[model samples]
Target: MAKQSSNRATQVIEAVGSFLRRCIGSILSAGPIPKHIAFIMDGNRRYAKKQNLEEGAGHRFGYSTLMNMLKYCYELDVKYVTIYAFSIENFKRRPEEVQSTMQLIQEKIEGLIEKESIVNRYGVRVHFIGNLKLLSKPVQLAAERAMNATWHNSKAVLSICIAYTSTDEIVNAVEESCKEKQKGNEKLLDEIGEGPLIDVADVEKHMYMAVAPDPDIIIRTSGETRLSNFLLWQSARSLLYSPGVLWPEIGFWHLVRAVLDFQKNYAYTEKKSKES
Candidate 1:
């Protein structure tokens, strides 16, 4: 009897929460909805330390928070979501710590392609962005499998940037653009007209992040305002939101607040994006 009562109470609470979210969603729909949002998921380690949990527990919790955020974004009809999952600089960490995080990432990535996973539920196409060659072979294979498994979906996009930094991406794009010029591609020659100079379009075509539009808003948790080498080129016009809460502690309200802030600055952001 006690178990039955507990289950009933849980169901009731969930039902009430769902209704409240729908109400907020309706209100948000009245304004301009952002087409893309990016996240710097910082402070997972800090969260773990704060909670006095084991070494990786913070990331595990952060992953759960990410799933919930994804669900919220999809429900709001936001079409593109990108996350700064890992950076090239992170490889300098202690070998054991790096290995543990990689294992956790591999395990979760495999789960994403399962039949009932949220990616399938929302028809989200998964993209593994950045220099994937830098990742360990097993992790790279897992990422490739996830991308292949979800490529057919069209409802939305989820770009996970691993082994990525904006500066590196920029350099890679420039090098690829130069290589094309060196190949004496007739189209490139005509565009530049007798100089080795490459145009913005030439460079952008080779960017790792060319898969999606530039983000409308970037939310960095743990109250960080700096971009931290993440999406520097793409964020010329994006609104930045820094909430004091840690990534694992972030909830639906944080997302709602971010969107509201974006809407408030919609005019300025839209104007700047066009200028760029």
Candidate 2:
């Protein structure tokens, strides 16, 4: 009898918490919503250690949190979301761990390909933005398939940065720009250049994230104060929010607080940009 009562009480608390979050979210939508939001989901490993779970369990838990977060963002009418899923630096970890992460990524990508998946239900266009060549061929294929499947979803856009690093992205843009210059019309180039000119415009045109504007707010979990090579160029004017909680532990309240913080300072942040 006592066990049943305890279980019922816990369920009631969870229900109340979810209700409050929805109410807060409704209020937040009244203001100007951020067009793009980037996330650095950190501290999965620490959470695993804290919980004394299997090494990879934290990442699994983080995945659920991420899925929920995505739903919340779309519900708030956020148009673009970029998540740092795998960094180039992650390859240095143990091979087994890297393989495990890749496997999980593959599973999630495949999940989105389901006919009734969230991507379809929410009208989210999915994009994988990074040096995809570094990913295993099967994973690459899965990613391409997912992107193709949701290419027409116009309500929201989800960009997953995997096997990526800012420095590598910059280098790739430069390389691609050079190739384009080589293929340019020589007669047209003669007036201004012996060789085709490659400027910031050229590079910007080739950047991986050229599909979306820069993020307005960047939230890094686990209280990490540094950018850590995530979205270096695109985050120039973004307000950084670091919450002191692990990735797996992030929930509706954390998102609400981040958005509220952003709303509190939106005017000033925009004004500073114009003055500069």
Candidate 3:
């Protein structure tokens, strides 16, 4: 009983710390804010193990954290937010884990369409960027519904990557371009054979995120420095922030710190370029 009480107290203390950090961060943020931000929410299972919680519980906590982070981003007047929710590589995990993740995604998509969700309240547009064919029928339907429901919103956009892979997206775009060219360039198609030949611009035009501008900042939690195949094309000029905190433990302060770091670096680079 004493140990359980101790654990409960720790949880309460951590929650309070998170609240305080957010309040402080909001006060400290005074410079130009990023218009777009992307997140690679990593280390869910590790967070679960560290907290002595179930695997699903960690993902649930991550969902809550994402909601809170979005609120903070909205407060900062960020117009675009993208999250790497699931990767094509993640399908290699245990079947049970993948199933649970699918269910969670479906729930989140449905929740986004709810009357009280941020999508409706703040006129936030929701988009899913990935291979929809890989998702379960219900989850895919939910994603489509969420996108359609908020398609007209102009205030903010939230993009969730589900079964997304930068390489796969590039390959798919090339294939699409080839098919389009085949119909129009019959003589060229006959001369060049069946190879998929597409320019970088052609692929960019077909990417799932074609409408959104490249992310200004990309934040990866759990101290992961690698891109892990997220947004290869769009992140070329993006400022990266790697915080040691796990996804379930991330809060607004971490984001604020990343933005400040970006501001400092951007100013330095701008001044150096002008001098040159």
Quality of model 2 by C-alpha lDDT = 0.90
lDDT top scorer: 1
Candidate 2 lDDT over 1-276, as tens digits, reads 999999999999978876876787788988878999999999999999999999889899999989889988887788999999999999999999999999999998999989888789889999998999999999999999999999999999999999999898899999999788767566556655575468888999999999889998899999998998988988888989899999988877787787888899999989988997
For 117-218, candidate 3 gives per-residue lDDT tens digits of 977887899989999899999999999999999999989999998999988888888888777766767687567667646667777888888868988899
Clash pairs, model 2 backbone: none
CA shift of 142, model 2, Å: 0.6
- TM-score, per-candidate, Cα-based: 0.94, 0.90, 0.84
Candidates ranked, most accurate by TM-score first: 1, 2, 3
Q: Rate the local accuracy (lDDT) of all candidates.
A: 0.94, 0.90, 0.87
Instruction: Mark the regions of model 1 whose C-alpha exceeds 4 Å error after superposition.
Output: 184-196, 274-276
* Candidate 1 residue-wise lDDT, 218-275, digit = tens: 9999999999999999998888999999999999999999999989988876687678
Residue pair clashes in candidate 1: none
Model 3 poorest 10 in a row by lDDT: 22-31
